[model samples]
Target: MKNIIENLKEYALETIEAEAEAVSQLPGIVDDGFGEAVALMARCKGRIVVSGVGKSAVIAQKMVATLNSTGTCALFMHSADAVHGDLGMIGPGDIVLFISKSGNTEEVKRLLPFVKKMGNPVVSIVSNRDSFLGTHSDRLIYVPMEREACPNNLAPTTSTTLHLVVCDAIAMALSRFKNFTAEDFGRFHPGGSLGKRLYMRVEDVFDKTNQPRVSEDETIKNVLITISSHRLGATVVLGPDGDLRGIITNGDVRRMVENGKDINTLQAKDIMSRSPKTVDKSALAVDALRMMEANNITSVVVLDGGKYAGLIHIHDIMREGIQ
Candidate 1:
């Protein structure tokens, strides 16, 4: 058992070394042919159809998904499935990105003639630049061989990472070309945690119940009753015309008690935080959160176009999601 464990550790260490080398050589591999491929994909009139078999197929799917989520429309076309009416998914003006380590997977090889007849630009990622698939490819991103991490050097670990990073490079390049923003990504992935973090508006999460407010002339005793009854530990102070003026929090009560102020006589304006932190209710929840973080605040008053919108506590974001 110990011998097996030692062998596994040795193999893992070698894998890391190979992966480092691959990452280092990625830039050099991105020149020339990579430019041609990126140009073609950027100018593509239709979608990018990724095709591969076995382990390469997984990488193909990931590339398709990343590109799709980043405003570059893409779809995965299985090599085996392509022979059976699946080729119908590919049309003129679309770019086909074929992936393979050896660059000679039989399933993919079978579709070379059909791909040629369809007149779509074919881009390929291959370990060997001289393989049959690479030879016929219009553009190629060569995955440099650093020896597999496998004990026998037969598995597809290092090569796969090399391809994945290259695919990401292409996606990121296209992302810049298309000006894909966090908002665009959020639109594509609305149900995911990342979408929640980017798209949720503050108006969607704030609570309006018992939104205690007091007039500028209200005494400290009235303020205490308002804060205690609201249970939010805070109260909004309004001006003569009902405009927001200040906020009184539990912290203010503590300060008042420490200063030995006469609670029964002091007015709300004398002890409240003037020009209190506030956010537009229509603003994204994440933006509101950032404002809170930057100001060292735990809560903010929400305003909806000149009206008292609501009050948002930091904890409310966790319960209702950022959106």
Candidate 2:
């Protein structure tokens, strides 16, 4: 079974090669029609109505999503739904982009009457530039590829990738035109993981119970108690005047063994990390995790407005997974 699996996995390499070739062919097809499509979308006052059926339907939905996130207003109207009176989604001065690999999908053709009646420019994405939808469109963008990534060469793998890549290109062009930012992307995807990653701040993922501290005059036993109570293997140490001095950790206590100092007699200031890695409480948790990994530290001391606030351990980072 293992041998058979290894042989079968070789097909994945073939699929990758095909996908790369498909993407490489995309640049040659971009020309005046591409510029016209961008210009139409940029100037249109109404929404961009994107319609497709079958596998093309999936690509159309993603394209519309990318468009909406990158400053172009777009609505995905399913072709089956369009024929069933969903054509009302399109308004005058709008632009329609219809997607079909063969340019003759039965459901896709059903949307033509509404497209014609809307009095908007029609743009078609198809393999055959002379097919029905292609001939009717004001402009046509041809994918021109003749193969698929599947072993049978029948699946929509390569063509769908091309569709999405072209969609992303158009969206990024609009993003440059409008200066779309990360905050802008957050507006359209407020309910998903990417949205949270974009907007959720460090304060949202910070540990609230930061009750672990040891004074500079605190005994070694008291420092141990602070470390155990915090469960972070460390604690912040403060000077007699109540200002931050350094940090005390288990490793710091262990070093006393070599110096012949008594654990219970020593003060926290005798052994502590003076220059601890500090992070702002307002930074993203994901970024904090990266900092911990880069510095090879298990925890970080968090500060609020330049004041000691809390400590975050590596476990807290994983359990929260970037709020």
Candidate 3:
């Protein structure tokens, strides 16, 4: 049993090391062909159509997904399905990427004529430049020669890893060529933790019940009540005309008491900070958090079109996993 466990550990490590070494040699193998392929896709007017068969097909699907999420429009057409009616998904001006490690996958090679007839550029990522798919392609990006982790060199181990790395590199290059920003990426995501971090607005964080607000003329005692009631650490002070006046926080209350001031005689305006930090409710919550960080504060007053909206606490951002 101990010998079996040791063999298992060594086997896994060997697989990882083999794949890593294959990936490391990719830069040396990259040449003008890869650059031309990226330039073709970057200049493509329509979506990129990625097609492959078997293990390479799975890599193609992942590549399509990454391309779409990173601002480059893309779709996956299974090589076998493309031979059916899936070829209709390809439109004029589209770029088709054919992924095949051996460059001779029958299903992938069958689409070469159809891709050419569509008048779209066909780029092949293959290990054998002399194979049918590579010879028929308009351009070829060669994958470095890889020996599979399979003892018999038959399983798609290192080859598939290299395919993933190559696809990701192309997607990132296209992303840089288009100058895609985090905000652009957020628009596509919009559901995961990444979307929440990038797209969450101050309005989403601060709402009516959590808005600790009090009139400027309200007594310090009333201000403290609002702050404590809402549990937002501070109260937004407003004027009689509903304009922002100042903010009174628990710290202000503590300082006033420490200074031996007549807490009973003070109004909300008396102990409040006139230049309290404020954020537009429409602003990104991440940006509001940056404001809080820069000002060394824990909360800020939220305004909607220059009017008081609510209060945003640092804890609110934290709850969204922004940090």
Candidate 4:
């Protein structure tokens, strides 16, 4: 069958190289217009309305999503639908961003007149800076693509890649100009695990049932029961004033037994390691995991107001993908 798989792999590599070459030209073309486009979107009083046709439509939708997620309010409108009453979605101060490689796509050209009548500033991201949309737009950002990855030089391959990269760049620039933070990004992705990882505090992951505790005067027999019940591999030892004293792990019990001491007579003060690691309950869950790894331990004590709050185990961090 002419080794169809190998032939396909070769063609894929060639397409990637062509697209990469096209992208290599982007750096030189990024000039004052790029900054101006970002300023326009940043200064916009209303939503950013991104419109395009065909392949550009796909990029526009993705750009809209990126913009909205990173603190910029944006919406996607297909070029064909804009003239058919979707133009109602465009507000007085909204900025219309048009994405078209050719700058003369039929659907986009047809919508440009209505776009102009709406009196909003039109910014065009087009490969041909001299084309209709390019010259007519209030501001134009040029993306000069040499050719497509298509062997026939007709399909939208490298051209679409350029469109996506340009839009991503603009969206990122807007995000930076607005000083978007990770906490701000978390607000937009609260439904996903990533949001939890970024925003979930250490206290949010603490388990009440896993609070292994013992006082200094308590017996080893009492420590064993607490550690077993809590299943946290260790128990916290508190002083007479109920302050944090030390920690005794299952290994401490084993080592005490191995030392041939009278296991029944040991107290929490005798076996506990006085220097237990602790993390503030207000710390991020990810930061707690970092402390655990750095100390080569599996769990850490949680403190609130300088008092014992609870324990955060490595398992809690792993469940959140921080490991």
lDDT of 1 by residue, 210-298 (tens): 47899988988888899888777788998888789989998988999899987877899999999888889888888788887888777
Candidate 2 regions exceeding 4 Å error are 1-16, 147-154, 186-197, 258-260
What's the best-to-worst order under lDDT? 4, 3, 1, 2
* Every model's TM-score: 0.89, 0.86, 0.85, 0.93
Summarize candidate 3's per-residue lDDT along 24-84 as a digit string, tens digits: 8999656887899889999999999999999999999999999999999999999899878
| Rank order (by TM-score, best first) | 4, 1, 2, 3
lDDT of 2 by residue, 80-177 (tens): 88878888778887899898888988787777866887688888888888788888888788888878898788999998999888888888987888
* Whole-model lDDT per candidate: 0.86, 0.82, 0.89, 0.89
lDDT of 1: 0.86
Candidate 2 C-alpha error for residue 202, in Å:
2.6
Model 2: how large is the Cα RMSD against the reference? 2.9
Q: Residue 230 in candidate 3 has what lDDT?
A: 88
Which portions of model 4 show Cα errors greater than 4 Å? 1-5, 257-262
